[model samples]
Target: MSITLTQLRAFLAVVHSGSVTAAADELIVTQSSVSAAVSGLARELGTPLLERDGRGVRPTPAGAAFAPFATDVIGLLEQGRRAAVESAENASRTLRIAAVTTSAESFVPRLMQAFATAHPGVGLTLDVGNRDRVMGLVLAHQADVAFAGRPPRDARLEARALHPNEHVLITAPDDELAARAEVAPHELAARTWLLREPGSGTRSVNEDFLAATGLAPRTLTVGSNGAIRQAARARLGVSFVSRDAVADDLATGLLAAIAVTSAPAPRAWHVLCSGVGPVRPVVATFLDFITARGG
Candidate 1:
């Protein structure tokens, strides 16, 4: 029997949601329907695709390997549908945008507003995620454009610098370090630091800053920008975050920047588009706006 899209979707949903029951809930289908689809898919592939893990489900090695293929198939088909719709209905043009959390909170809104003002007919769909999720959306052809603090490394993608991104060490306004005129790097080593989780672009930059300054601090991993900002405000620890992300806090005396002898040079926020082909009309229009803005 041929593998059908229904089976593919069911299998992928189960793989993502980690349970047949959860997948059924998400897909609005019966549990038996999801189970049968996945089972049929496994049989057609001649291997077990999933195994139980704790109270949920987990993809086996084979299932894990097949996920990208499944995502690409779904993403490409969806892209085709959108393309056909856009062609037949010019007034319904939509641009799917994905952005890392920091940029989403900081600069993406202004850019989107300006773009919308310029092209009232085009619709925008913005997805906020961490770097990995944003990059995956772009790579899968699910996003027409993506904004990230750092450029993606995939050669299949093209990237452009949209704006500057500056990171700084921040502390509670009343912290002793905040009063110092020029704090030495060694002084920070013994203090606590609020760090982003692994695989975050912010975490990578923070690590680099620590290594470059030749200091190590006791670290606490905080998962989100808002939480980290609150932790800093509560005087729990210092943190390295984008100036853009903490601009209002800094301006209102909620957080203070430490004056250091050597600080990280400014990086950039990048606009990324995946795939190596002539640009689509909507994407090209956005890129042209980006160029004009950046220039």
Candidate 2:
């Protein structure tokens, strides 16, 4: 009998997730079923693929060598299946998206909700990460579309402007900076600042503002836009973020937008995809829907 896609998936899931229980949970199968599939696959290959590691499992040397092949086979099959489904019944295709944290928190979910309402038969998946991770998803073909606050620097990506992403210097409502109609760059030079991790799009913009103003304030790095918002609201430090991310907080008087000299130029929301090929129909549909929404 030929090796089945199910067997490959079971093996790869275990290898990637580092445990059979986690793989079973992800696959929605019982641990015994996952073990059986891996065992069956090993029998078909006439070699051992995995072995017990303490209470869990680890891929054998042979399994490590075979892992990439299994992944590629599964990826190719998924691509072929998506192509067939799109050609036969376009409404059933899945649209996969990856977006940076700011876009994800501020607009991407609502956009996906609206898209789902308009295209009820289409399956959708949205993954959120930092700018680098989102760009990596697009480059790896793991996501059909990518959204960010800035255009991707990768030549392999084709980017389209979506909407203006207005960034503001935000502080707690009670902070001294909050009382200013406009805070000058020099005024910001010595304050403590809260910002996103180094590779995030927001941090890139924040760094540009810092460079333009020649300010190197003491800074703390947080992993998500939500965290930064919370930190700013707590008066931990000021942060620069897309206005969309803090609109509710701004309106509620929880956070104040501080005007700053030599602020980063207004950046636009961007949609990106692989530059070299035609996208799936569902992806095209999502792209059209988002572009029509004015970001």
- Highest lDDT model number: 1
Instruction: Give the TM-score (vs. native) of candidate 2.
Output: 0.73
Per-residue lDDT of candidate 1, residues 1-295 (tens digit): 6988999999989988999999999999999999999999999999999999999999999999887777667777777777778889444999999998999998889999999999999999999988888888887787999998887677757898877898988899998888889988888888788988887889888888889987788889999999999999998888889999999999999999998767778898889996644457889899999779981
Give candidate 1 misplaced runs (Cα > 4 Å): 139-142, 151-158, 174-182, 197-199, 207-216, 220-227, 248-254, 261-265, 276-279
Task: Report how far residue 75 has shifted in candidate 2, in Å.
Answer: 6.5
What C-alpha RMSD separates each model from the true structure?
3.2, 5.9
Backbone clash tally (model 1):
0
Candidate 2 stretches with Cα past 4 Å from truth are 1-78, 89-91
Number of backbone collisions per candidate, in order? 0, 0
lDDT of each: 0.87, 0.84
**How displaced is residue 169 in candidate 2, in Å?**
0.5
**Model 2, span 1-295: residue lDDT tens:** 6899889999989997889999999999999999999999999988999988888788999998788667656765666677886778443678888989888888888888999899898888989899888986776568889888777566668898988889989888888777777778898777788878878888888888887777889999988888888888888888789998899999999888888867777878899987645566677778888889886
Candidate 2 C-alpha error for residue 77, in Å: 7.1
